[model samples]
Target chain A: MSVLVVIECANGEVKKSSLEAATYGSKVAQQMGTTATAIAIGDISEENLKHLGAQGIKKVLFDNDARLKNFVNLAYVKVIAAAAQKEDSKVIILSNTNIGAAIGSRLAVRLEASLATNVVALPEISGSTFKVKRGVYSGKAFAEVNLTSDRKIIAVKKNTIEVGHEAGEASVENFSASLTDADFAAAPKEVIQQTGDILLPEADIVVSGGRGLKGPENWHLVEDLAKALGAATACSKPVADVDWRPHHEHVGQTGITVSPNLYIAIGISGAIQHLAGVNSSKVIVVINKDPEAPFFKAADYGIVGDAFEVVPKLIEAAKQLH
Target chain B: MKILVCISNVPDTTTKITFTPDNKQFNTAGVQFVINPYDEYALTRAIELKEAQGGTVTVLNVGEADTEANIRKALAIGADDAIRVNAKPTDAFFVATQIANIAKQENYDLILMGKESVDYNGFQVHGMVAEMLGIPSITPGVKLDVNGNTATVQREIEGGHEIIDAQLPIVVSAQQPMCEPRIPNMRGIMTARTKPLKVVEPTGSATKTEIDAFSLPPQKTGVKMISPENAGELITLLRNEAKVI
Candidate 1:
C-alpha cells in the first residue's frame, strides 16, 4: 500500500498548498517505509505533474477527461476512490482548501476512512495508533487527535508545512473513473478567476491592512508592499465590510483563515476575531500608530508608527531585498 | 419548503482562550458562549427564506444541555422548532452522521450552516452529511436564491465566486454576504418559549478520532519595538536575523 496525495492544480500548475501536501504525504510515506503517489485533479499540465517529484511524489495519476477540469464534487470523489483502490492506499493527504474540504469529507464516508482536517503537523505513528496535531478553537488552541480507523484521511492546513524541493521526476499515468451525467448535476454555470497571481490561501507571505489605512483610496500602501515582496494582499474584516477591499481579501474569523510564514498587519487593531484567522501565522509583524494596540501583544515584531510613513519605508526596504 | 439550519455554541470571539488545569479540555468556567457568529448568518437566511416561501424552519444542535440555550436563541431568531441531539461533539464525522440521520427522517428541502464553527474549525460536517445522503453540498456560500425545486448558490473559490445551480435537497454552508444576521426581537423571543423543542438520542456513531489533549499556543515573545524612523532597519533584521525575507 502507498500513501496517496491529492494534488490541486490551477491554471495548469500545481498550487503551493498542494505542493505542501505532497511534501507532507511523502514524509509520511517515508516514515511508513512506503512511497507516495499523487492523484491530480483540476487543470494541470503533464510536464508540471511530473515536476511534482520535487515534492517527493514517486508517481502521478491524472484524469484527462477535460470535463474533470472544473470541480464536480461527486466526480472528484469518484476519481479519488478509484485511485485509492488502484493504489491500495491506506493514508490519503490533501490540502485543507475549499475544494479539499468539500471533497475530503465526502471521500472519508465513501471510503470509510477516519478523517482529520485542519491538521498542522505530521502524524505520530506508534504500533497501531496514529495521532496528529491540529489547530482548533479557531487558532486559539491545539488538539492532538488519534485516528482509530484502519484507513485514514488528512487535510493539512495551508502554509503549516515546509515544502521539500528535492529535484526528481515522477512517472505520469492517465486513469479514468467511471462517470455519468449525474456527476455533473451540480456543476457551476460559470467559473470566475480571481485577478491576481498570488492566491491568499497559497501565499507564503501576506501583507494585510485594516481600517487604519484610512479608506479605499489608501489601499495602495498595502498593494505596493505586497508587490515589493511578491506577497498576497489581504484586509481585515472592517475593510472588507466597508467595501474598501473585496470580500475575498478579507482574513478573519468570518472570512478566510490563513497561516502564512510571514504575516504583515498594518493599521489594524488586533481584534480577537481578526486574530482568530491569522494567529497561526509563523511570524506576525504588526505596524500600528498605537503602541498598545492589542495586535502588538500577539505580534512577533511591532512597529509603533503611522501606516502612511511606515508602509512606504517597508516597501522601499522590501524592494532592496531582491 | 422545509429548511434545516444547524447551529453550534462556541466561545464568544473575544473570549481569551485558556485550557483547564490538566490542559486536556477547554476551560469554560467564566467564558461566555454565543451562537456561532457564522451560524447566525445561516439562521438569518433560513428565516428570510421561510418568510418568503412559507416553509417551516428547524434549528438543530449536537451537544449537551449547555447548547440548548443557543438552540432556543436560534428559535427566537426565526426557527419554528428545535432539536438537541444529546451528546457532546466528538468529531466532525460523528456530528455529521447524527445530522444526516435526522435530516433523512425529516426530509428537509434545504440544509444550511456556517462554513465552519469558530471553536473546532472543522469544515467537514456539511459535505459529510451530503455524502451520507448522496446529495450535493456547497460551502462558504456568499449568495443563495431559491425558486421552487431549484437553488442558485454563489460560493467562494480561491480568487472569486462561482454561481451554481442545484436541484432541491441540497446542503449549503453559508458565509458572509449571504445576509446580515438578525437579532431576536421581543415578540420572537416570547413566542420561542412555547415552540416545540425535541431531544433525541445520539446516533451512536463512534468518533473515529479522539482528542489526546489541548494546549494554548505559545505566547508571542514581547514585540520588539522598532522605531518608525528606522523601519528599514527592521527589514534588515528580518533578512539577517529572522531570515524570512
Candidate 2:
C-alpha cells in the first residue's frame, strides 16, 4: 500500500511544516518498502508541488478547486479521504498545524483509522502492531503510543524532524473529489493572513521578551534584535496578558508552543508554565538581570545583564555577521 | 439554549512530571491536580452564555471517581449540573465516544471544551465528537458569540484568525482570550455541594491507542555563563561557535 501525505501550502508555496511532513511520510514509506504519494492542497502551484520530489515523494495529487485556497474542513477531509482511497494508502501523514488537526481528527473517524497527533518520531512497525512516541503534557513529557488499528493516521509535530531534500522532481496529476455546495457550508467568512517576515512556529530563530523588558513602548529592543537576526519575535504570557504583545505572539503553556532551533529569551523569568512550551528548542539562551531567574537553569547560554544595555550590543554584533 | 463544557483533571502546571519506577505511568504521589486550564476557558464561557440567555450549563468529565471533586469544582464555578462517566481515560478515542453518547441523548445546543488537555495535549476530542455527531466544529476558538440559534466564532489559524458563523447545536473548542475563567466564591461553592452530580457508566468503546511508557525529556546541558560587558562576544559565539546563524 502507498502512503498518502497531505501537503498544505499557502501564498503559492509549500509551507516548511508541510515539507517536514513530506519528509516524514517518505521515510515511513521507505520503511514499509512502498512509495510515498502526496495530496497537494491549498494555493500552491503545480510546479512547486513537483518539488516535493526533493522530500522523496514519488507522485503528487493536485486538487484544482480554487475554493481550497481557503480552508474548508469538510471539503478538505473529503478530498483527503478520496485521495487515500485512490492511492490505497494504509498510512496517512499530515502536519500537526491548525488546518491539519482540524481535518486529521475527522479523517481518523471517517476512515476508521487510529490517529496519533503531535507524533514526534516515526513509528516502529513490528508485525501488525505500530508504536510511535508522541508529545504529551504540553511538551513536559513523551508517551509511547501504540496504534492498534491497521489503518494509521500520524500527525507529525512541526520542526521535530530535519527536512530532507533531493534534487529530483515528482510527476504531478490532477485529482478531484467532486465537491458539492454542502461541503462549503462552514466556509470562513474572511481569511486574515498575519503579515510578517517570519512565522514563529516555522522560524529557525526566535527572539522572545518577557515582562522584564518593562513596557510595550520598549518592544523595539526585541524587534530590533529579531530584525538583525532575521528571527521571529515572541512574548511570554504576562506580556501578552497585559497587551504588551498580541496573543498570537505569546509562547507559553497557555499560548503557542514553539520549538525553534535557537530561542533567545530576554528579560523573561523562566516560569514552569513558560518553560513547558519552549523547552523543546534545540538551544535556549536566557538573558535576565536577576541572576536568580529560574530560566537560567534551563538555558544553554546565560547572560546576567540589563536587556536595555545588552540588546543593542547584540543587535550590532548580529549586524556585523552579515 | 443548553451548553455542555468538557473538563479534564490534570496535574498542576508547576508539578515536575515524573514517571513510576517502571516508567509505565505518571507518578502522582505528590502531584497536585487542577482543572485543565484550557477547559476552564470553555467552562467559564458556557456559564457566561447560560447566564445571558437563561439556559442550563452542564459540565461533563470522562474520568474515574477521583475526578468528581474537580467536577464539583466546575459546578461550583457555575455549571448548573455535572456528569462523570466512571472509567479510566485511556485515550482521546474513548473519551470522545462517551461525550458523543451524552450529547446525542441530551441534544445540547452548544458543546464546548478546551482546545486540548494539558496532560494529553491531544487536541482531538472536539473534532472527533463533532464528526461523531455530524455537526460543525470550530476548534481553538478565540472568540464566540451567540444570538438566537446562530453562533459566530473566531478560530485561530497560523498567523491571523478566521471568523465562522454557524447554526445552533455546534461544537467549539475554547482557546485563550475567549473569556476570563472565574473562581468559585463561597456562596457558589456551598451551593455546588447540593447540586446534582449524576454518575454514569462508560460506553466501553475499545481504545485505539495505549501508552506503553512515559519519559521526561533529556536533562539540559549546563549553561555557559557570559558577562554583559562582553555582550558582543555572545553574538560572536552564537555565530562562530553555536553556528546558529
Candidate lDDT scores, in order, read 0.90, 0.91
Shift of residue A312 alpha carbon in model 1, Å: 1.9
Interface RMSD of 2: 0.9
Tens-digit lDDT track of model 1 for B1-245: 99999999999998888888888889998999999888998999999998998989999999999888888889899899999999998888899999999999999999999989999888989899999999999987899999989999998887667889999899999888899889999998999999999999998767778888888888887788899999988888887887777
Alpha carbon lDDT of residue B97, candidate 1?
91
The i-RMS of every model, in angstroms, reads 1.3, 0.9
Segments of candidate 2 deviating more than 4 angstroms: none
Model 1 superposed RMSD (Cα): 1.3
Candidate 2 docking band = high
Interface RMSD of 1: 1.3
lDDT of 1 by residue, A196-283 (tens): 5588988888999999998999988999999998899999998888888878888988788999888999999999989989999988
Task: Report the C-alpha lDDT of model 2 over B50-72, residue by residue, as the tens digit.
Answer: 88889999999999999988998
Q: State the lDDT at A316 in candidate 2.
A: 91
Each candidate's B-chain TM-score, in sequence, is: 0.96, 0.98
State which candidate has the highest lDDT.
2
